[model samples]
Target chain A: MCLLWACLLRVSRSTSCFSPVSCSSWAAAARRCNRWVLGVLAAAVAAGTAPGSSVRAAPGPRRITTDGRRKQDLAWSPDGRLLACSLYHTAGQIGVALFDPAGRLVRLLSTDPVEMAPAWSPDGKRLAFVHVTHSGTDGELDIHEMDLEGKTRRPVIEERKAFDMYPSWSPDGRQLLFTTTRDRTQEIYVSRADGTAPRRLTSDPSLKQHPCWSPDGKEIAFNSNRDGNFDIYTLDIEGQNLLRLTRERASDTWPAWSPDGRHIAFVSRRDGNPEVYVLNRDGAGARNLSRAPGFDDCPAWMPDGRTLTWVSDRDGGWDVYVLQP
Target chain B: MLCIGEQRQEWCGGVRRRALVQAGFLGALGLTAPQHAGLCSAVAGRAVILLWLWGGPSHLDLFDPKPDAPSEYRGPYPTLETNVSGMQVTELLPALARRAHQWALVRSLFHQQNDHGIAGTIQMTGRSPQNGRVHPHAGAIVNRLRGNPRLLSGFFVLGDRLQQGHRLIQGEGGGQLGVVYDPLRVTYDPVAGVQLGEVQPPRGVDSARAGRRRSLLDHLAERSPTPTPARDAEALGQMYEKAFSLMTSSEGRRVFELEREPPKVRDAYGRHRFGQSCLLARRLVESGVPFVQVNWSTHVEAEEDAGDGGWDNHYRNFEMLADRQAWPFDQACAALLDDLAQRGLLGTTLVVAVGEFGRTPKINPNAGRDHWPGCYSALLAGGGVRGGQVIGASDARGEAPAAQPHTPEDLCATVLHSAGISRTDVLALGLPVEGEPIHELF
Candidate 1:
């Protein structure tokens, strides 16, 4: 499979300058080659006949999710023992679920139909997520913090008539930042730990989403489409010191800061399909952490800052994967 | 064979058979009845101009906006106040908002059959396709009741021909009523010019000249010892005569010459094919055609995704509606209403703008609205319709009808009723029309 890919890469480089052929035809050839390689690798891995497997104990990123469901908005628990994510089953059930580091189903936190954007509190005792209930076309979205040990879930930010989503707990756990369309457009907002007294931030006329606080607790990173397509941008807690991180034409979203505050991991379509990419804090030296086929989205940095957990559909369906970059 | 039934003569099963035979005989002699030419002169009576929005449009985003509904349901845009009190439309329709007094809205329109093909047939025919039997198109039934009137056809369909898959969409053509009542299908292009390929005679064959040629051919055929030439001649000769009349008549030619309209008036209708088609519909109605259907676009979903194809909006509904679908519709519809009113044509022309169904209110994960036949909206203007009033209401989320729920057949009945075609006449013709004329609209 590697040899075929290498040959195709060489062939692509040689044929790229041929003006008579359109780029779409070249893309088709590359796609055919990739599909063949993926099919062969999948067969070998399934039959246990391959000496060198892609998911073996090699020195590279490892896939943790294999449930064949759509997993999104992945976040590591404060202690990093488990990962919480929103899973959409093929049968049309959407809920939040927890998984151990080894990718085992720990427990479904909530199967409340329309839940997404699960965030763990800094103390690791509670989970904060958005639970939405729709009535035909009209729906209510509210943030709920669930007690891990009991059924003591309570509303955090119950904006009854708004799409308040993508909640994140501050490093100190006293405040939460979330994206809401309460003002007619998607913008970021800050709320108290109890989800009260919400205050608006980042009031751009365009859509802003997937906000993550920097490890230092002073800056918040989020993706916005204020500049045509979505790109990552960071702003301070006071809504000042705005900085643009990624400016590629392709969509770059779901920004997550490393534990050491040195790098920001994001999902970008720059490489053709969505892939996990890491860039320096100062917006330089960007490199892809997951170069596999299929869509890779919502990368969350582990506490150790060496591993990044994300959801990928490369194995035919979405699963959580941990990459050591 | 043409005897009366046990109950009533008009309700007899052989009425359709007799009608067909009568049509055939008259068609053979080239004495087809001219229809509704005096329809415009009759006070309070009017012709119908149908702006068929092929796919279902989202009611929440356009007519029955739920500003107070939940964020996901209300969508991103704010509602704007129209010229009429207690009425509001989406900010996307500013032009129509200003002209709210000239039109009335039926907000509680609903029907079954969510599939595009089935719903389109039901809405267009005003009767569901039952047991695999296609009903006559509403226009066909109207043309049947009010025969061809001047030298022109009564029903005209302008723009790209409507289709589902490779076949003409159900109800787009004549069904059990026979092809004689089928709409005069016409295609128009700004650069390539108007094409009436099906209705235009061979070059240099004016109406008088074509009639002379037909007589000569008939004389030759009678001399020849050919069997069953009379029936074949009747059908072929009928087509040629209709084509000749349409291609050569001064009135027919004048209605198609869109360059007669001022440049400013043409620009007001937008430069797109759908807008220009609406402009052409006005001309046909003015020329005394009883039913003129202006299709929004030709290719529905075959060329683009759902939303771009006349409001299917299966993917990125907000972006597609905000960018591609809403503005052109608002401009063309508003401009049409203005033009019709200024020319005093509104009093005699009933304009109905609607789609097969409405989009789902609960947006899917793709940010697109799927087909929802449960509830939708239709706009009615002119033909003595009470303007600035909403006929019925949908629920807070614009999901289903809350008051005076009406089906697609009922909407069709309303359109036919506005055109002064009685429900009794429709029933006598063996059509499956349902609902009343929406008394509130009248």
Candidate 2:
């Protein structure tokens, strides 16, 4: 049985190789014999592991944001002095935090259920993000704005019984674009900077999420799964002239427009695993910027556009890293 | 009170009555004649198809939407109005939402065990596990009460075999009632064509040859004749007869052929395994099978099989459900309800769908949900259940049942009751039945 299992594993790492019809039987067999096989496999895996292994800094991709907790939705302050991110702490507590340009922890801006697509105000005085008031069953999600230097936080847009998230401020900071599920499906919406008078931007049954605004505020780029899988898409601020940027079968998501608007930095799982990729504005010259293992996702461009910061689990846990693009 | 007395009388007399019936069946098996009259009277003619969602699905994100909760607890989705006034479900279930008049939900169904197998045992057997003994599954109990009628097995489990690592999960087999009452297990991929590997005879073995072999065995039994050989021979003969009937029966063979359904009808159920399995389940019940369980993807481990859709969404709960799980479930369940109603089988067939438990109210940092057995929900449709009604309520944050919660046993009692088996009836049959049917569901 062990030899047969070993042969099966060696032949196919992906469950795709096995016939779906027989997988049910094999899965049943695996469950029945997994305990004994697990021990042997564990021993084999342990023997394969190098002794006294620890996470070491890889050659490229310098580590930037380091707090031993999860960090997501990263954005750079206009002057490049600070980084704003949705920070997750122990005991299910979550909030937004600021990191200095030198990779040091700044004060946590707000520690509530801060979720999705944190953005910096053009002048860099306030942060906009989706704050989750309650979670799981009977939960509410809304876009929130808070002063970076103060404790004052207010709902920019309150969605009473729906999910309103992924807020991205326009380059002029006068309009905020975000994604909401209030329409019963994910659609893009643009609201006033203060979160009043919101108008629906894009309407589709397919998911349209993680909207990002161009620096010039002329176009809005976001991820859509309308083509069966998620791909980068761009549209005018009025939601007209829709254009699909990336055409790969692999999912390309979380589009971050470069400051100069020449490239869009995004995450793609096209090469079997997620990696940071940068593509030119017209979808040509697509190059993988982060070639490291583990999931490299949510790429945020530094103000200079020559550098990019993203989250990676290559060190066994999520940490922010900056790469010279 | 009258019902209790009648049930008790039946139970007390049933032991001796069953023995006599067994002897008659054995005598009949010795001959080549089919027991036609006995078959009709033995069965209740009613059936149930349980779509068991193997892993614990998040109640918050499915049937029981808590839209007013905070964002972290609210999840990333929104709730939409269903056809039933004042009833709302997550947008992920748009298909089911349109058919709300066909189903009812018990939003307060819950139990203590959170682990998959342990909770599965609780849900399947409708009993809290005791150290020394195992409780019979509802199907097993049904099998014992309504014996197979040579037409079809009383209980059948379709789809992937459920197991935890290397062992079959608890409460899946016939427990205290013994293995003979266990459902006929058919492991097949619903997405691929149905092929009952072990249920069918080996290739090149025709029914005539099978009958000849049975005769040879019978001849040998007569020649040797050990003590109690009649009873053993009867049991073996019964087993052979069942297999032969399944292989030779036109209705049985046709029911397993999913291709026989129209393309539009097949597409309505969606092309996925769960959807296809549900359609197959309908065919099974339509063919007179008493109980059929179509388990939704038995690969229960969250990490390896999340894409396969067992609802243990401990990590990437939102992504996993959004990407693959909810759409198929919504499409399949709605299609099943529609097909059953259109075929006029809904009145006689009871359909139940549920996972073992619910996910935590608090969303973890991984943007996922963990196990929370404190409160959950289950859906019931068809049979005698009143549709478009919510039987119970969860707390403001969905932390626990707002009122007194319904235990797994209560749900089981309701299922049995819908199948025409009263709680007292099971008790009188010398089975350790627990919990009362939720009277509100009737």
Candidate 3:
């Protein structure tokens, strides 16, 4: 059986030269290998040990949990006791929820109707989202703020036809920066926390979205398609200095600064699939921390700064998992 | 005949003997089976041109305006009188109104699904996706039924095929029918004026070289003994033949060449992606293609200070519709209808314009509309359909169908029927669902 397994592996590797005779030989070898593997697995079960543990251990950062829904745009409370996540379902509507540290659903912030890009305030007392509406003749989407109770909702801006989305509140809760289609091009706009006197910040023809502010509130990181494909970019709040952070030929989005302000975690498809990666503030020392087979996205740093929480589908569904740095 | 040997019995009862006797009996009439039955003469020569609104366009604002409705439900645009008395259309669509005598306006098209993915499947396939799984589009069914004879291609889509969340917008192509029935997609950067990167032939490979390559490939295919390889080689030969024909065919080249159009005519259509696509559709129909679908895509990125251009207008309803969206559509569609009429192609070509669903009647605080799947409008012109007619009606608020409510299946059936293809005769390949073409319009 061992010899047959080895022959089957060898034949499988040389599939480019397969012929009728080799095909029959390969079938025989594969059957033997299957039986041998089954036998080893059975023996391991009897011995109370997992088979192929050594082989599986080579891939670092093992999967902890997952759920089927597409999880993205995640955030953690200031104390790191709860994780806020946006759950995307097949119907195109998004549900915002909070989970305990043990991966248990603690609260359901919103559900059913479609919601776009939900963000928690710095104090985690209020949630900001874009409310979508459409008349028989026209349609509109505007920014709305809701308290933790899902009550006391009010519109930040009441301009019809303009699309305001991806609201990110400042750490001091005095100002907010969001992406809006006020000028026909998606540009970043800054407004007071109460949504007063919105000022357009970015003015390029490129598409800008997913704005996240730094810990010190001096620098803002966002994703833009200005350079052809979506990539991570950072700019000062005053719009005086602009910096390109990523240059890979893949979509890099949803940049979140670590609590310590030294590293940034962002989602990228550079490795053939969406995974969470961390790079230095200056875009160096990039490493894939959530390299699961399925999509691993929407990484947020815990307040402790030692562990990161992200949404992954390693368990056949999207769920929150923590990675210790 | 009595106790004949097996070989003799076969020979005596063979079709050749039967044919000889029949020919001898009908010698003076000179009629064969095919001629007698008129089967050869019944070949379909009709074609259909579809104007696909990728994101759902508002029915109330366009075809089924309800001016008497409440202020919020009534859209921003005013209704205009058409050539047909008592018929009204959006004022912006003056061109379509003038040619109202040439087409039928359906106001009560309805479906169950409001989601773009599901609604699109219903509209394109005439049957909703089974178990919510993606299915082949309608153009694919047509392509498979009638193979592209001129090698000019069968199904063609002129925009993005998919929407947000990777949902398959139906009518784009064959989803599971494999690539053979997939529409010859022509993707472009609408804002940047970039054509499809794939359609361009290899650099320096002229028409003569391409023809030579095709002949070589065909010869190799004929000599190959293996069935699989031979089949693959033949398919490749067909592809090359098509590519060569498409590249060298004067009609094909002329159809895609927008620059050759007179400046006044081009300007009349407005300088927008949808307008350009509509113009291209006219060109393709003139080139003898069976099915041409022009998708009005909503993938335009948010523009700074500019209202949302796509149909998924969820925020600023009046400002966007009046200033940006409706004007370009008005001018281009008007020009297309006018052009088709002046060229005498309107009688032979069927033009259909519709979207997945309509928007809600109640206005939100943001002055925008949400998706409404209960009722909508669809416009049909040419191809022998009765003109100057409104088939159905909506309520005062245009909220629901007040008269005859037509399903996407019904509209698809009408399209097929107009193209001289009987819905009952043509069966969808690989789908378990059954469809019968709508006969009411005919």
Candidate 4:
């Protein structure tokens, strides 16, 4: 299997630059080769058939998990020692599952059955995530923060009949930036770290989601359908200077600002399906980073802006993978 | 001789003849009439693919965005224009938006039952049984008239046993039409592939072994198989025969080998259980199965797992749609329509995608939509139906029908009518169909 993968890799590299091949055909060969090789190595390691040495020597991209379950909302810890992601700990169950930088399970953080979009606090002592529960007459969704022992008390953002999600903490950890449907339509809001004294930021009636504070803490970036379909948008802390960064007819969402603030990594449907893409902070020099022909989403930058962790279903099921671009 | 008897199980040639004779006797007594008495033409090639989105999907957020409604009512999500004129759907359905010309939507479908059980029954069987008698599933009624191939039972339900409130959903079984008319429920395990249930022989038991066993079973059946007090003996006998055939007949079983589909085709369907099941539903209908109902999930689970949970979105409605549900549905349903069209089966196959009811027009405290049976939407395509059309209209707030309100009976009647079964034919089968076909579709 290794030899076959190696030969195919060589062939794919050789054919990629050939002028006569159409762009799609070129992509097809390379993706097939990548998927086959990565799927094989990951499967072998998962099955315990390959020793650590083979996996260490043969891989191109590191697969976080070969279980082939859907995983997303990747967040690298502030100290850069751990990764937090929403992964299925059991069949049909999704929650915050932590992993070491090398993809070893650190611990299963929450068992809420549906907690996701985890954002680690700067001190790495807590994980703020959206927990959804249908225990109420209707259902209730609120962002909650879990301490090191996986204990959650008061919600960070909970209103009587409102939804608050995608809790991105201000860089200083004194404030929480999130999107809520309280008081009015879906819009961004900033509240005290303990879910108090909330102030509405955006007045757009259009739906907005996945709000994250830029590392500099001076601006906020989110995806909204404000200009029609969903596109990447950024604004200052005061919700002024709203700038649309993407104009593709297809939806662009789930923006993760590069740690260095030079670029934004987001999921784009411009290619007709979800693929991880990177564009400059000003939305220039855009390119598809995960060009494989299937759903690739939730791109998050590592402490080093060069690496990203995302989820892809290209190998037939949702699995986490890491690649540096 | 048309046989109508107390026995409801659909049997093979000999037993079917017996039932026809009994039915003829009943017809003579004016108790029931033969379905052939109807003036409707039964199209042998016509089939129906019912994509049962088990739990109620939000009408406000999906087909009817109600963009101008109040914040509490409209929630989030904007609408986008479709290929069809004067029709729009939520941006979550971009794929479906592009292919809107290939399908039509009925915006005002409603029933009084907000509970999943009764509503599901009403939708699947056309009307709930007020007389305390379970009505046959529409598929059973369709099969009673159109008659599916013996190789693959005409009606196939792809998913596990669906239940609510700890009991199986009301109309999933064959109901009073007898266990035989009950759909052949097939479970597709994402990891284990197609779990064919009784159709597949046990491990270490290959086809040849199963074939010998089948011969024995056939001989036993010919000699009058032992009584099954739990179910009709003839029905069990018929099921045994079909399972043997599936195991023995390469062509019959190969239809299930979804891997036979191109990787690209499978990916095009979005690579999940629901998506693949849609692909399988298409394959079944294309192979001449008369009725196929693809249950979105085995059950309506409000809490989340990955994406396989039902559409009951009482909470986390937007998250469920944006994260797990909507796009995959759009991609798969669109792909199904596209594939059927490409295969030229679209004209013969009637594709209906709907849920038991719609979600609340108001967004709930949990950012989810609760069950609302007052108004909903259903999508239809193919089977001689005109596409790129909106059959009805919803109120501005999406709380009720503003124009051309239709009932679950109308939805069922539409499926049957598209499969060439008429309202009179349903009556002839001793089944009551309350709503007439929405003729505007054609």
Candidate 5:
């Protein structure tokens, strides 16, 4: 079992070079078990430290879309070429929209109303999103990753009764992080990119959704309210080391890591209303970024780490606002 | 015995309404103990818009903020000062806080049932389910007491029937009064505005043909699972009357055309489901609909999953409320109040906004509040009721009523009273429990 797990863990880390043997049913179990062992061993040997760099001061905020449609939960592609956002097509209608950095519509991947919260796969060839269906007694939320063409879709799990939503792909595109009620409550979960080999990372679920991966693939930073209030926390890929990054009585949710993994951008209500805040990996020097009036949330960092995009209702209704500072 | 406010009953201009609730009590109320005809009448032309929060909203989060309580109970949000002195709401509700003087807050509402199905039945019916004899929803009761002739149905639910999972909440319909009194439910979406899906006449079916098919209203309600067909000849006649009422009443049909309103008006209500629905409710009452219950969502737990859900935030309560629920409510509810008052409809239209119950006082491991029927809050406005007042009070921790703890029964009675239904008339209806109106508002 150890040998299988070790081999599977090695194969899992290499996304493009995954062998068929590592993707077998046993591989999922092995990877779930052996990844922790390998990660802990690797952490002890490596000087586990991230550079503490912050965002530099920059320009004013700009609106991305003015079509008057409500957009939600943005994901900046790994290549920094485009962004995928959940767009409101009409009332009771929501779909994934892909837009270039210039706010031009590259293409609408899917116009299906049930789909929401689009996240781009590291390869940029595919997009993972929440596909909501009301077939079950209660509405069901499932994660589905599809190509940009909107063809060829598959569920994250072969069969799921519990609600799954807001999927985040690993940098290597081998694993996906999402929130699921598989355990009868919403919790952070990690499954293989193919939706096999499911694993539970955190039992404490406070709905501080959207767990993002570090650029180095060593740690995963997410917002959790397990400590009485919503705050950001970082845990190693192995789930062995967990560190609280932001300490605020107010909710500091939706954490997004910069490309360099130097700074983390998260939304906070510490200043009365929600504002975009960026803090170093050590949780120091937290400063308000988007000081706009209405309420700002869902902060997504640009790959360059110089600027980020967030949604704000400052001008009456919610629109994508980009702020450099 | 008739009064407007909870206190100062007789002195509160408690004009005794006479002979309005006459001989129909036995047939309408369907109670075992028959009432005498000496009952006072309910004020006519009075309308009610019940903004059903559906799932239980958190008392600690919305109107009844426990700022002085421990972090475990207080959670994240701090209270913001409202226009009315000493009234504070969650910071997210700045819009509602600014207009606090427009509505009265009842902070000490409590009940025994924490389960969604039971508690929802309690609030909707204004009484607990007893001996399998479910009480009629407050809206149905209001309509039964005083029907609205201008509208197709006396009571209108501006959304789908309220439900939790597969099980329907017991008393959303006419209940003991019979299904004939069920609120005419309509659905509202951004693209569709307000679609009278259930009540819409079939395409190409002229008025004469529609009349021939007296079962038209029976086979209607495609959006609803249970379509109410004509049960008997009398019901069939009533259904036929309803069909012709909407088919011919162009004035009544115009109320559903939400686009007729100015762009500024629609924009002010915010471009969301709850916002648009509230606007429709205002239009409904404006057009003489006696009761309008605007359901927040069809089911209980809906965060981003459904893009909409009710106040039953068992998990992710704060996040859901902040992102999905609270701000829209603040914008739409405030807009609704402002619109009613601006149109001169506020004086006669009674608007009640409340969920079934309140959430738990202490925060749970899921970072959400559980169901708590022990203490909750609601907002009451218009209908000749005085504003800028806080009724009752919650304890320091907001775990229970600190003073003047009232049940859902009182809320129902208060709604009826505000809509011109007198207390003695309610007593004459043979209701299992007659909830007294909170006389403080008058």
Candidate 6:
């Protein structure tokens, strides 16, 4: 896998400025080389005679707990070791805490007056969260970042009069995408990691919020009220070529792209109480994986593509839960 | 010679009488001052409370019921008789029914915008959104006309500000009229039980400190000296005045204190955010505010599978209508009417309860209704309006107005007029076009 990635990177760089003749020749040579490599690997695996394995298989997600606190919005560290989840409190206070693969609490990341929607940096050195002040004030939200040890707290965006929420780190970790209220209406905005040069991405008069980036960073998925109710939508990084992903009377929100970029998981109220559901990247063959009769939200894909973690209230009070494929 | 002299005197007397008659006629028609001045001045000192139903409430289920409509359209709620012999309100409003004599309910308010954003703009601004124009809200208009000395702000929004799409609802703020004319926005979070957003200082800044800051700012201003626009300056000044008033005036603080009210009274208003908002509106009006708008826009959470909590009941119309939605409104609205009357404010204050538009007359398969802008109902009380009266009617199916349809502009005009503003009070937005207040309601 590493060798293939390296070759693809080299080819992409050469294609950037290659002449038409050179590009065609290079493409042909690459195709022939890929075929030969695949043939040899298949033959060796079939014979069980390979001397050393060159590629590691994708890990299956571990099942943490099924007790039902509706654990959602999982963020894995850059080293792929620790994960963080947004835990909903029945008393209406939202907190963020870290957990290991074995479902053990590792550390408490944030205990703000009100915090939810945690996003980890590409380097996993810092965590960004939507810190809410004064409980129900609409525009009292600010984007905050803190180190993994819950130290060195700093405000990434500090115009305290408008709502700044649902922060998502860019693929390069140099920028962030979040939702903010303009003239009393919610819209998506992208800003630098240091909170400079904020630019609006969507101009619709509907409520646009909960922005999530595709793993490849080519597209962004968000929830909007453009259709008179909440539905999932996607737009390219430049905010063009908008597409609707879900269509029904029920509301769909908090979309998270799978690590492989082939599927998108989201919370929907279509079957009554909100539950975790997944649809293909092309928005086809949609299915509900968490069919339990309880409210579920904030679906996050484990590094191992086969497991999902979410927040649910099935056990009465909100707690984190995991599901396995 | 003596007879001719007498005839000349008689002709002179006749000319004087003719001039007197002409002046009297003009005055009676209100083209002059005396005839209508008393009528307008009667409400000059009184306050006005505007009960803004944020999402459009259903007219058929509340004020304008059509019992003969199909089951899907009518739902399960029945119409009940009010104190007025020939009039009836919905069963959800029994408390209001008993006190029907204290309020005048208009059953035919029509507008073109069915969407919340557009409709809200029209209802608040008194101008159709289709006119491709925006105007100041009715309260702002009142504040501009009736300048007050003791009060910090003439107009106020009691809870969360009105919002739509990515914009605050037009007219909810001072538009072209500038921020000085903007309503004092008091935002509060019920869960936190704390006021959020802008808070003006209650007392004047210490003289020495204020002088020092003023001089420093003024020096900076002189260097820039393009003269910040007048509107911007006015808005800043208004903010300063509001901050001073809020921080200094005991009355202002007391008006916002919900805990000061009798426990039973607070409970009677319900523990919900909107119910408390209504209670606060009454307090503001009583405290000498010229205009108070209570916005019911807070997000109320209930059981996940429960019916509608907000008035935007797109689905499960009957279940929401019977159980969750209408009950709180029924209790609080009825209580408000009674409370206002008991306080003797019903006669002086103009209290209106209305939303942007009405719901669809037809019910969808999910037992919900969509947006309907054709016709709706608005209730008006006090400010010398006659009680026990229903002014308009809907067709048999409650689909559209059968007679006397009132536009949002007319309602705004009525509110302004009740607050002693002449229809000709020009709110100079520096635009070419001029706004004319509605005069028919008075």
Write down the TM-score of every candidate: 0.54, 0.56, 0.51, 0.76, 0.72, 0.50
lDDT of 6 by residue, B1-442 (tens): 1111112112221122112112111111101122112323423467788878766888888888776776556644456778889888766676677788887877777878877877888788787544655677778777766746445567878766665433555667666565556765565343333242233221233434444543554454345425546555554444343433333224335456566676456556654455677777776666666788877653322112121134666543443454445656766776777777777777778888898888898765333467888999888888877888888788887788898878887787777777776554543434232233333333
Q: lDDT tens string, model 2, B298-370?
A: 6564322322446776654666675457766887898999998998888778889988889998775434578
Better of 2 and 4 by lDDT: 4
Kindly provide the TM-score of model 4 when superposed on the true structure, using C-alpha atoms: 0.76
Docking class of 3: incorrect
Q: Which digits, one per residue and each the tens of the lDDT, describe model 2 over residues A1-325?
A: 2333343233222112113333344445556777757555544333322122222234467665434355778899999999888665432345678888766778776645434456888999888877766442224568888788637778898876556778888998899998777776667899899988899988766667689888899999998766655789999988898999988855678899999999999887676456899999988898998887446777898998888999875543356788777
Best prediction by DockQ: 4
Q: Please give the RMSD to the true structure for each candidate, in Å.
A: 18.8, 18.4, 22.7, 9.6, 18.0, 25.1
User: CA lDDT of B191 in candidate 1?
Assistant: 34
Q: What tens digits encode model 4's per-residue C-alpha lDDT throughout A1-325? A: 2333344234322211212333345446657788767555544444331112224333334566555667878899987788888886565667888877766678888866677778888888898898776653234668888975687544778776677788998889988998877754677899888888888889856678888988899999999767666789999998799999999866789999988988999988777668899999998988988888667898888887778889877655676677788
For model 3, what is the error of residue A119's alpha carbon versus the real structure, in angstroms, after optimal superposition? Answer: 29
Collision count for each candidate, in order:
8, 24, 39, 12, 9, 17
> Per-residue lDDT of B1-442 in model 5, one digit per residue for the tens?
3221121222122111111111011111111111111111212368898888988889888898886787668766767788889888877787888888888999999988878888888888888888998998888778777764323357878887667876667898887666567777677765444555555443444556545443432333233343334342354344444435445444445566566676568768876778889998887676566788988888876644343567777666776788778988888999999999998788888888899899999877555688999999999989887788889999989999999989998998889888788866656767665678888876
Return the number of clashes found in candidate 3: 39
Candidates 4 and 6 compared by TM-score, better number: 4
lDDT of 5 by residue, A1-325 (tens): 2333344334222221112332343345546777766544433222111011122123456666544456778888878888888876654457888888766677877755568888888888888898867654344568887888788888775346666776888988899888776665567778889888888887653444778899887789987656656789999877768899877767788899988888999988777678999999899989998887667888998777877898876544566777776
Per-residue error (Å), model 6, residue A97: 22
DockQ metric for all predictions: 0.02, 0.02, 0.02, 0.17, 0.09, 0.01
True contacts kept of each: 0.00, 0.00, 0.01, 0.16, 0.16, 0.00
Per-candidate Cα lDDT values, in order, are 0.69, 0.70, 0.63, 0.73, 0.71, 0.63
Q: Across the candidates, what are chain A's individual TM-scores? A: 0.82, 0.79, 0.77, 0.81, 0.78, 0.74
TM-score of 5: 0.72
